[model samples]
Target: MIDPSAPLPRPRSDLTEPPDVPQVLTGALRVLQGRLLLHVSPARVGYFRPQLDAGRSGLVLCGPNALQQARKLRGAEQFGGPLLVDPAVYEVRAASGDEPFPNACEDTFAFDDPLAVSLAEQRAVGVTAPMSPTGYLHAEDSEALKAAVRQVAALDDPQVVFAAPVDVGWLREEDSVRQLIACLRLVPGPKALMLGGQMDPLARHPRSVDHLRRIVAEVPGAALLRTDLAAFGALAAGAAFTAFGAGSRLRHIVAPGEKAKTSKNFSTSPHVLFPELMHFFLGKTLADRFAGAAAPVCGCAVCEGVRALDSFASNAGDRQTRAAAHNVAVLMEWLRTLTALPSGRARQQWWHERCLAAVDRYPLLNAQLLQPNGFKVPPQLKRWALAAPADEAASARADANDYRRS
Candidate 1:
C-alpha cells in the first residue's frame, strides 16, 4: 500500500542514468546461487542477519520501517549484498526507522502506489505492475494503472517485469490488453513479464490457463511466464517460466488444521506443507515429470539433490517455509535442466517431466507442516496464523457488523 497522505519522498532524477542491469543481475546471480532470498520485517532484521551470512543472497525488507533498519546493515556487517525495500503506500506510516541520512544509501525499493508517480521516478533494474482478476478487480482502477505506467515510462528503466492476471485493473481482457499495448508503446525496449496464478489442484479450472495464455500473448516485452507446476507442462510448450516465490497464501490444498487457513504472514512465512499432504495435493507422478526436466539454477540449492521423487520429498519438511524452500530448490533444478537441454523436442520433454515431479511433491510436504503439532513456527507466525473457530458465530457476526459500519 502506498502512503497517499505522507509527503512524497524527494525524487532523484539523476538515477535517470540507465543502470548497468546486466552487470548488476550477474552479480546478484553469483550471490543467489545456492543462497536464499531472505525477507525480514523491521523488527526481525536481527534474526535474519545470521541466516544471510549462512547463505543468503539478499533480503526484501517489507516496509519503510524495515528499510530504515536495513540501512544499518550496509557494508560487511550485513549478510547479503543489497537490501530491498518494498514500500506499501496506501496504508500505515512507514515501518522504516529514521530515514537514511545521506539519501544515496537506499539499495532496493519496491513501490506499490497507484497515485504517487515517484515510485517510477527511482531508476531500478526493473519496474512492474501487478494486475490480477480475483481481488480488487475494478475497472475504475484503470486511471491509477495509467498513472503507474506514465511514471515507469518517465523513469525509462530498461528492464520491466509485468506481474499477474491483467484483468484485475481493467474491465475485461480486451481492455486490459489494450492498456498493456498502450503501455508497451510507451516503454517498448528490453523488458520481462511474468504471469502469476494461485493454484487450486482439487478444483481445477480452464479459465486459469486460458487467462494466462491470453495475457502472455498480449503483454509486451514478456520474456518469462509462470503458472502452477501442474499447468507448467502446457505453458512450457511455448514460454519459459520462473517458479513463484514466497507469497502463496490460500494456494495450498493439503495443510493441517488451522495451518490450512490463510493468515497475515502467508505471503512472508517460511513454513512448508507436509510431504504426505503434498503427495495427495500435488501427486508423486507430477514430481517425476518435473524432476525429469531438472535444470541448473544459478541461485538455488534445492535442485542439487539427485534422487527419487519420494526421497526428495522425504527430505523436505511439512511446514510452509520448508515446503516453499523445497519448491524453490526443485525449481532451480528445472531451470538448470531447461537451460542445459539442446534445442530439440526430446530435450523439452525431458525438462517437462522433471518439473512435474518436483511440483507434485510440494503439496504433501505443505500438508504435513500445517499440523498443529508438526512444524514449530516462531511465536509471531503462530499468532499470525490463528483464526477464529467456526463456533465463534456471535463474535464473527459482531466483527462483520463492525466491519460493515466502518
Candidate 2:
C-alpha cells in the first residue's frame, strides 16, 4: 500500500533532466532506458517475463481488457514493480454515451475489487481516477470530481493516483487550474495528470504552452503523463515526466465510445520520429534522402546492427522494435540536452534554435512547419529561420555528420 503522507515522485535530480520513461512493448524494453513503463494487455501478459528478467525498474500499466485478464491469471504478483490499473473509463463512457462526470464504480474498475485488492496486497497498484469525455473543467464540476476522488480514496490501499484527463485549454484559465488543483488535493498519494484529446492543437498553440508552464510551476509534484509525441515539449517545459505508447498510432487519445481497430498489417517498419519537424519517416524515405551518402540515420544498437547487415527493412516485429528503440534514444538525447541548459529560458532558446536549424537543413519539411495545425515555431525560431537560400550540400554534410556521431 502506498503511504498517503509520502510526497509525490519528484525528479531524481534537479541538475539532471527527468528520465525518459517510455511506455514500451515487451521486445523494445531491451533497448530502451532501464526505467520503463510497460503497456500491457491481458492477452500479452505472457510477454512480461522477458522484461522482468532484464532486471529493469518499471511499472506495469494494465489496459482495460488486461485488467480483467489479470484477475483471472493472477499476473500482478509476477511483476517486480508497481502495478497500475487503467480503468479505461473513457472507453466505457464512449460505449455507453454517459455524461463525463459522476462516474459510477460499476461502470469502471473499482479499487476495492477483490482482484485489485489482492494486487495491492502483494505490490501496490495505481488507481486511475475517472475522467470526463468532453474535456471540460470548471468550478461547477467540483462536486462530481470530488465524487470520483472519493471513490479512489475509499480503496484500502492504492500506490498512486492518476487524475482523469482534462482539456488542454483548461490550463489556459487560472480558474480551471485552481479547480483541477482542488480535485488533485483530494488524492492522497503520488499523482499524475493525464492530458486528454489530440495534442496537435496544444502543440501549435503558444498560449497553451505558456499556461502549461504556469501549471507546472504551480504544481511541481504532479507529473504529466501524455499519450502523444507532444510529451517532448511538456518535459522540456518542466513536466516531472512524460510517456507515449510504443506504437506510432498510440500517440493520440481515443475518445469515449470510440472503437479502436487493430492494424491488419502486424509487421512493423523501420522509422524515426523527428521531433523538430514533428513527423515520422520510414527507413525507405530516409534512405532516399541520403541516396549516395552514408547517413547515420540512427545510432541505436538495433539500428547499428541493422546497418551492418545493410538491410533497412526486415521482419515486422524486428522493424517495430528497432524503430521504437531509435525513437526512444533520440528522445532521451534531446531531453538530456534540454535539461543540461542553465535555466528554463535557456532550454526554450535551445529548442527554438534546434527547430530553426532543422527547417534550414530539411527544406522539404517547410510545408509541415508552416502548416496551420503544425508545430507553432516560437518567435525566436521564426527569427532564426533561414533568411536566404539554404546550402543543400552543406546541410546534407552536417546531417550526415550529426547522424554519424549520434
Candidate 3:
C-alpha cells in the first residue's frame, strides 16, 4: 500500500523499469505500478477515491484549489504518498476563459516572497515544493526562470524541482534543447520538464525525437512529465519517466492564449496515431479502410466489439471513457517493451523496426511515411533500414514463429 507520508521516489541511473506517472486528474489509474505519481486536481477529488481504495503507491498532485480539500478528506492521513501542490498560477494568466484574477495584469506571484513562504508551509504538511509555472520565451527569460527556480530551491530545499517550458515548438531547434538543458542544470536537484502549450506538432516531428535523445544524453536524470501521449517514445530515448493525463480533454501543458471551454457534445471516437505515418484516423474510418485487410487497427477492449463507425459514435460518454483507458493502456505497453530492452540504442532500434512493421502491415499508410521530410528513420536505425523488404518480412515471421513456439 502507498503510504501518503512517504518521500517521493528519487531518480536512478538505471531506467530499465522507469516509474509510471499518470495524470490521474481526469481518468482512473489503471496501470498498477508500485510507487506511481498521480496528478490530481481539487475539483476532481472525487475521481481519486477509487485509486486510494486500491491502495496504490503514489503521490497526489493537489492543484491550488484542491489543496484545502485534500487536507480535509476523510482518510487524508491514511493515504500513502506525499502531496505535491501545483500553484497553477499559469492557469490564472492563461486564456482559459476563467474569470481573470483581480488586477490580473499588474499582480505577479513573485517567488521571493509569497511563494517561498507558502511552499514552506506546504512542506510542513507533507506537500512537495510548489512548481514554478515558468515559460521559455527567450534566452533571457530562460535565464531568469532558472535563477528564480534556484532561489526557490534554496528556500524550500525540495527533493525535485518542477518547471514548465512554454512554447515547446522551439524544441525543433537543437539550440533550444541545449539551452533548456543548461537551464535545468542550474536547478539544485532532479528536474521535471513540463512542455507548455499544444505539443502535437513537436511530438510528431521526427527531429524532435533526436532533440529529446540529446537531452537524455546531457541530463540523464530529468523527468519528462505531463507530455502528449505521442511523445511517450521519449522513454526509449533516455528520459527517466514520462506521463499523460487520463482526461480526454486534458493536455500535457497549458500555454498563454490557450482557451478552455466546456461542451455537452461528448461524442467519443477512437483514433489510432501512427507516429511514423504522422497521421490518425477515426476508429470507424480505420475499420472501413481495413474492411478486407489483415492489419489490426487496435486490440484494446473497447475496439473488440466495435464493428462500425456508428457504433463508436453512439454513446459519447462511454466511448470517451473507453478511449481514454485504451490510450493509457497502449502507452503502458510501449513502456514495458522499452524497459525490457538492454540499452537506449537497443530500444531505439526496436521502436524503428516496430514502426516499419506497422507500415508494412498497413500499406495504405505508406504514402505518408514515405513522403519527403516525412518520418525519416533516424541515423541510429540505419543498420535495420539496410535490410531488404523481404529480409525484414522474414525476420518478423521468424519472431512470430518463435513467440508461438514458446
Candidate 4:
C-alpha cells in the first residue's frame, strides 16, 4: 500500500498540461551500450533512478490505475529535461462507438489525456502510442485500434513500438500465428517488435532456434525481443540489436514454495535467478557467438563497472525484484562491454565461455535442491501453483523438419 502520510516526491498536476522540459532528453544515448528502454511503474520508479543515472538510455513511463503517479514521474527532478519520455496510459475498457480507440481496445487508456498533452507542450520527448497489453490487443475493436494507431502516427516522434502478439500470447496455434503476422504488417510507421524467450516453450531449447531465426530475419528495424538473459545471447548471435524484458521475472522471485513469500518491497529479496544471468549475458556466455565484428550494446549499471550482483541482490522483498534489478544492471553492463569490444570474434569468445559457465552453474544448484534430503519445496510454489506443463505439441510447432517436409 502507498504511504498516504509520506510526502509526495514532487508536486505536479494530473492535468494534461505542458511539460517543464522538452528536448530529445539525451543526444546520442551513446553512454548506453545498446538501446535500453525501461518499463517503469510508480512504485518502482525510485529503484530505477539509480540505473537511469548510471547510464540507462531510454524510458517508458507505464501508468495503470495510478494516473497521478504518472504525472509525478514526468515532473520528477532527475528527468526534468529533454529525456525521451514514453508514456503508456492503460485503463480503457470495452465500449461501443468509435472514440479514439476500439470499443474493446484495452490499449485505449489515456495517452492523449492531460499527461500526454503536458509532454507534448513541453516538447519533452514523447511518443503518442500507449503500450497495449500484448495479447489483449488482438480482440480490440478495429476502429479503436486504428484510431490509436493513427494518433501515434500523427505524433512528430518515430513509430511507437507495439509488442508482438506471438511472444506475449505464445501464439502456437497455426491461425494465431497467421493473425499475428498480419498484425505486424499492419503496424504503422517504422515500428519496433517485442518477442519473449519463455513465452515460446521451444525458444530456450534446440528445437525452435530455426523458427526464431526466421522471425528475427523477417522483422524490420531494431525490434524488442523480450526473453531471459540466456536466450537473449542465443538470438544476439544472429542479429545486431535486441530488446529483452527483465521486470516480469520479478513476479516469481519469492515463490511461497521456496519459503514464505515475503510481503515487503520486492527490491529487498533472492528467490528468482540471480546476478549469474547478467554475468553470463554480458561477460561471456552469449557474447561469444557473434562472430561479426560489430556487436550491439546493452544499457545498465552492471557493465558500468559494477561487477557485484550480490550487491544488488543483497536486499529485496522477493528474489524476483532482486533478479529484475540484476537483469537490468547486467544488461546495461553487457551493452557497455559490447561497445568496448573491438571485433566480433572477441565478443563471441567472451559470450561462449560465459554461457558455458552459466549453463554449468544452474544445473548444479537445481541438483543440490532436489537432493534426496534437501530443503522441502517452499509453500509459495504450492500456493501460487507450479507453472502448468508445456503443451505436448509445443515442441512440434518449431520443427525444422516441418518446413523441410513442406
Pick the winner on TM-score between candidates 1 and 2: 2
For model 3, residues 1-406, the per-residue Cα lDDT tens digits are 1122322223435444433222222111122222224455566544433433233223345355455654554245455444455555555453111211111323435333544444554555545334544333322244344455555456544354455544555465655565666555455544566555443434434465555545544563455655543334455555544444434333455554666443233333554433333234454544444444444445533355342332343335565445434444454545555666764457656766665565454444435334333233333233223322334547988999999999
Q: What alpha-carbon RMSD in Å does predicted model 1 have with respect to the real structure? A: 16.6
Which residue pairs show backbone clashes in model 3?
2-80, 3-80, 3-81, 4-79, 4-80, 4-81, 42-66
lDDT of 4 by residue, 12-81 (tens): 2652432221112123322222344554555665555555434424444444433455445455553542
Using lDDT, give the best candidate's number. Answer: 3
Residue 205 displacement (Å), model 1? 6.4
Please list the residue runs of candidate 1 whose C-alpha ends up more than 4 Å from where it truly belongs after superposition: 1-61, 64-66, 69-84, 90-140, 159-175, 181-185, 188-205, 217-220, 223-243, 247-328, 342-406
Any idea what lDDT model 4 has? 0.37
Off by over 4 Å in 2: 1-57, 60-83, 94-143, 150-158, 172-174, 199-201, 204-206, 259-271, 275-278, 282-296, 305-317, 332-361, 364-406
Models ranked on lDDT: 3, 2, 4, 1
Return the top candidate by TM-score: 3
User: Model 3 scores what on Cα lDDT?
Assistant: 0.45
Candidate 1 per-residue C-alpha lDDT over 267-286 given as tens digits, one digit per residue, 9 for 90 to 100: 43343322222222222332
* Model 3 lDDT, residue 294, Cα: 41
Q: What is the C-alpha local distance difference test score of each model?
A: 0.34, 0.44, 0.45, 0.37
lDDT of 2 by residue, 1-406 (tens): 1123323334347424432222221222223222224344445444333323232223334344645554444444544343344444444342111233324345445433432443343232222221122222322344444455555556523233444555455555555555565555455443455554443435533455545544554453344553544454444444444454444333444444444543333243455665445455555554444454444444543355345212344344555445555565555556556656754445545655675676564554434334333333433233333211124435767998999999
Candidate 1 Cα deviation (angstroms), residue 62: 3.3
Task: Quote the lDDT for 291 in model 4.
Answer: 32
Q: TM-score of each candidate?
A: 0.43, 0.57, 0.60, 0.49
